[model samples]
Target chain A: MAKKLALIASKGTLDWAYPPFILASTAAALDYEVCIFFTFYGLTLLKKDISDLKVSPLGNPAMPMPVPMPNFVQMLPGMESMATMMMKQQIADKGVASIEDLRRACLESGVKLIACQMTVDLFDFKRSDFIEGIEIGGAATFFEFAGNSDVSLFI
Target chain B: MDFDKEVDAKNLNCPLPILRCKKGLNDLQANQVLKIMATDPGSVKDFEAFCKQTGHTLLQLDQTDKVFTFYIKKRNDAL
Candidate 1:
């Protein structure tokens, strides 16, 4: 009896891009139908370059302080790598599955994974760059699908 | 029991654990139970809201120290 949920994913990194999938998965777990639309940096999720996804530290003033240094300074050296490791480990430690694992589960669970057509064009990405089974559509189409959803999240 | 599937999501942050649990339950029958073990504090609120908004039954909720457990029985046929 669960209502549907639309999760909009916009981030690039595994750390920043997990919310949409997480929310959609949970909604589906609750027996609600789920849909996820990946736009902008969120498209990186379906790419093979998943490991290269990282938060841009330069303009991000709120990046968590590593030690006593300012966030700007923390962006130096291997900070991105450190952050990625920490985030990945945290997700794993929490007993949550990996992005790839979750992605597979989602496919099997009937979660609709959509790639934003505008974003694909904006980034000049070839269709081959994305995963094989995703549906490519515009915002209007996505919204149409999401119209009756009881819950919607922009992650 | 063979009737239930468990998803351990303890110590996880918002969304992923919940997402994993969701995927785990999606394939279950209407009366099947999906047990979720989570440690994120947000889960308490997130799952509550999820059930309310989705119309699923949040059959039981248990929390201890860093562990949070949820028992959700699918009821799509009743929808």
Candidate 2:
């Protein structure tokens, strides 16, 4: 039997979004069966329209800037979008795959995409609002899968 | 210096190089060697972990400047 990996994606920021997707795709390539459970803000990534996925620079000490900016400046209106744009540009410049590309790669590699049913209900998301091939489930379902996984991570 | 196949993963970062190497190795016969050239600095550890996890043979690893070259042999039991 193939090795199993279970991952939880709980954050929606661009930087936060990459770990589960990257790990899942890589684990699939390594012949491990990977399942990613998207909950809370992470459900936004599965939405058909991902334009709202912004990087929160405010209070995010890890957010790298071309020029150092104070926390107060990051709290200014529009700063989050500016930081998001900068991050996107940096990712593009580095030839890294975009979230869309990574998502497609994960699917191609047979990684299972699961969305939190509770979050979907809480956020008023319709099944049709997300990309195809997503399985909707609650924590119980996630625990069942994770129980058999060789590796489980909460990212 | 002999390899049955070569995968150029230059400029690809993180898991991309390892993913490409995994896919490339799938095409080779048992014991056939594959050479992967990558520019990502993290690929050294990534490939090591990949080989360890997948049960492939890491024949040799060499680095010249920024490029990392890994020679791997496919294991027959790898499916």
Candidate 3:
């Protein structure tokens, strides 16, 4: 039997969203049965329209700035958008696949996606608001999958 | 090294090369070799780990300048 991989995506920032999707897709490519549990802010990525995903630069010290800026300076009104643009530009310049492309790849490669039912209710999100192929489940379901996985990650 | 199929993953970075190689390998019969050429600096370690995890055989790995070439034979029992 193929080894299993379980990933927990708990953040929604543009930068925070990449790791789980990237790793899950790569693990699936390696023939592992992969599953990703999206919870809290991470549920935003599974929304039908992800264009609203933003980067919170105000408190994110790790947000890469083209020009070094202090945390206080990064808190300026327009800094979040500016930082988001810079990050997107850098990702494109590096030829890395876009989030949309990665999502598609993950789906095509058979990486299972699960959205937290508790979060969906907390956020008042309708089932139709999520992209296709998502399973709605809570902690028990995630624990069941994680317990059976050979690799488990929280990203 | 000889291979049944060739995949050009040059100029692609990180997971793209591995993703492309995986897609290419899917079409190959068991024990058939798939060759991948990539320019990503990370591909050497990536392919090694990929083979180890997927149960494929890494037949050859050669590098020239910025290009990295890998030959992988599909595992007969791997899904």
Candidate 4:
């Protein structure tokens, strides 16, 4: 039997969005049956249009900056947007696939995408807000799949 | 080395190359080999791990002028 991978995605920063999609696609390529449970802020990643995703430098001192930046500088208005654009440029230059591409790959490779039902309601998201082919479920649904997974991760 | 098919994953990073390699392998019959070319710096280890997990064989990995070339033989049992 193929191995199974269960991932819980709880964060939704532009930087944080890559992991669940990347791991799920690669695991699918490796013939593993994979599923991702997106909750809280992570549900934002499944939105039909994700152009607004932004990476913030605030409180994330480890984020690379072209020039040394103080915490106050990072907190300035528009800094988060600037940082996000710059990081997107860097990712493009590095030939990294965009989050949309990776997510598409995950779906094409048969990785199951599940959105937390409570989170959807909490965030006031309609089912139509998400892209096609996703199921909505709660924690128990996550455990049902995770219980049989060979690898389970919370990202 | 000889191969039945070739996939160009050039200028793509990390999992793109790996995913392309998987797709290439999927199209071939058992024992057929797929050749992949990638420009990702991490392709060497990435392909190795991919082959390891998927039961494919990495026949050769070569690098010349930053272009990485790998030859992978599909697993005997692969569909």
Candidate 5:
């Protein structure tokens, strides 16, 4: 009776990335057979250069910070990197753990990591760009696996 | 009777109790039972869903006013 869990991860931002990882990790911990499908922007999570993935500060006026800062200041060249670093540090400080940690936990707990084949082809990325132990597949593959699952989520 | 492992998850919500229960289960040997004590009303449904999805056996559920307890046996320890 072990049901499969399919998580559709489609965003690259720190906020967005955490949800899929956290949920999948938690599900796996519960001994639920879980798989995460990384597509489009979400594919950035597996890149060797994780520092490059960023959350856009544009349009959203409510991005929280310890101190009040102008939108223009946040848009500066190095600000995105700074923000990512700060977010990483904050997560660690709060004992919330990192996405890397969650990924490791998920893998250790038998959670499957899948990269979307269509998205990879769309983005023109090679398999070498992904981390080790990740399986590559398409929508049909995921649907076939996920169709019988009791719980399926899009994060 | 086998002694069941207990986890107190007071005031935790959504995924926290379930997360802790999972971690606790992982620490045990196969077929060992874990009893989770939770105040979250959602835990009943959540743990039920968890057992259905994970293939674990949910042996019992006890509710007394504000507290809820679940007895779950770890089934995937071999993995």
Candidate 6:
């Protein structure tokens, strides 16, 4: 039997979104069965409109910049959008896979994408909001797979 | 020095190189080699781990300039 991997993806920022799908796709490529549980804000990754995911640099002193700026400067009204644009530019220049690309790879490779049902209800999201081919499930369903996983991570 | 196919993973970041390599290997016959050229520095170690885990053989690892080249031979009876 193939090794199983379970991942909980709980963040939605552009920067935070890459890890789970990246790991899951790679694991699937490596012949491991992989599943990612998208809960809380992470569910945004599965939304039909993923083009608007943004990264915030506010209070993130470690975020690399052409010139390091103070938190006050990062807190400026337009700074978040600026940071998101910069990050998008960097990603394109570096040939990094966009989150959507990685997520598609995961799905194509048969990685199970599970949206947290409770969170879906809590957030007042419609099932129609997500892309095709995702399951809606809660913690018990997650534990069913996570229990036997050879590798489990909360990303 | 010879490979049945080549995957141009050049400039692609993590998982892409490996993902492309996997797709390339999938199209090859057993023991046929797949060569991958990548510009991402991380692909060096990533390919190593990929080959190790997938039962593919890493025949050669070479570098010239910024490119990292990998030659992988697909496993017999590979899934």
Local distance difference test values of all predictions, in order: 0.75, 0.89, 0.89, 0.93, 0.79, 0.93
Q: List ranges where model 6 is wrong by over 4 Å.
A: none
Considering every candidate listed, which one attains the maximal DockQ? Answer: 6
Model 2, span B1-79: residue lDDT tens: 8999999999988778987898899799999999999999988999999989888999999999999999999998866
Q: Which 10 residues in a row give candidate 6 chain A its minimum summed lDDT?
A: A59-68
Error of 6 at A42 (Å): 0.5
Q: Write the per-residue lDDT of candidate 6 for residues B5-65, one digit (tens) a residue.
A: 9989998988799999988998999999999999999889888898888888999999999
DockQ metric for all predictions: 0.46, 0.66, 0.78, 0.85, 0.23, 0.89
Give the winner by DockQ: 1 or 6.
Answer: 6
lDDT of 5 by residue, A1-155 (tens): 66578888988887787888888877776656898888888998877666555665555577777777788888789877777778777665544656676677777777888899888999999989988888999898788778878789887
Those runs of model 3 whose alpha carbons end farther than 4 Å from true positions after fitting are none
> TM-score for all predictions?
0.71, 0.91, 0.93, 0.96, 0.70, 0.96
Q: lDDT of model 3 at residue A135?
A: 98
Model 4 per-residue lDDT tens digits across residues A37-74:
99999999899998888999899989878899999888
Instruction: Score candidate 3 by lDDT.
Output: 0.89
* lDDT computed for candidate 2: 0.89
Residue B68 of model 5: what lDDT? 90
Error of 6 at A102 (Å): 0.6
User: If ranked by DockQ, best first, what sequence of candidates would result?
Assistant: 6, 4, 3, 2, 1, 5
Here the TM-score of candidate 2's chain B is 0.95
Error of 4 at A46 (Å): 0.8
Q: Report the candidate with higher DockQ, 3 versus 5.
A: 3
Model 3: per-residue Cα lDDT over A23-91, one tens digit each? 988988988899999999999989888765677667767755667788888777887887788778888
**Candidate 1 lDDT, tens digit per residue, B1-79?**
2338888877667666667665666668777888988888888898888777655678898877879889988767633
TM-score of 2: 0.91
| Candidate 3 residue-wise lDDT at A152 | 96
How well docked is model 5, in DockQ terms?
0.23
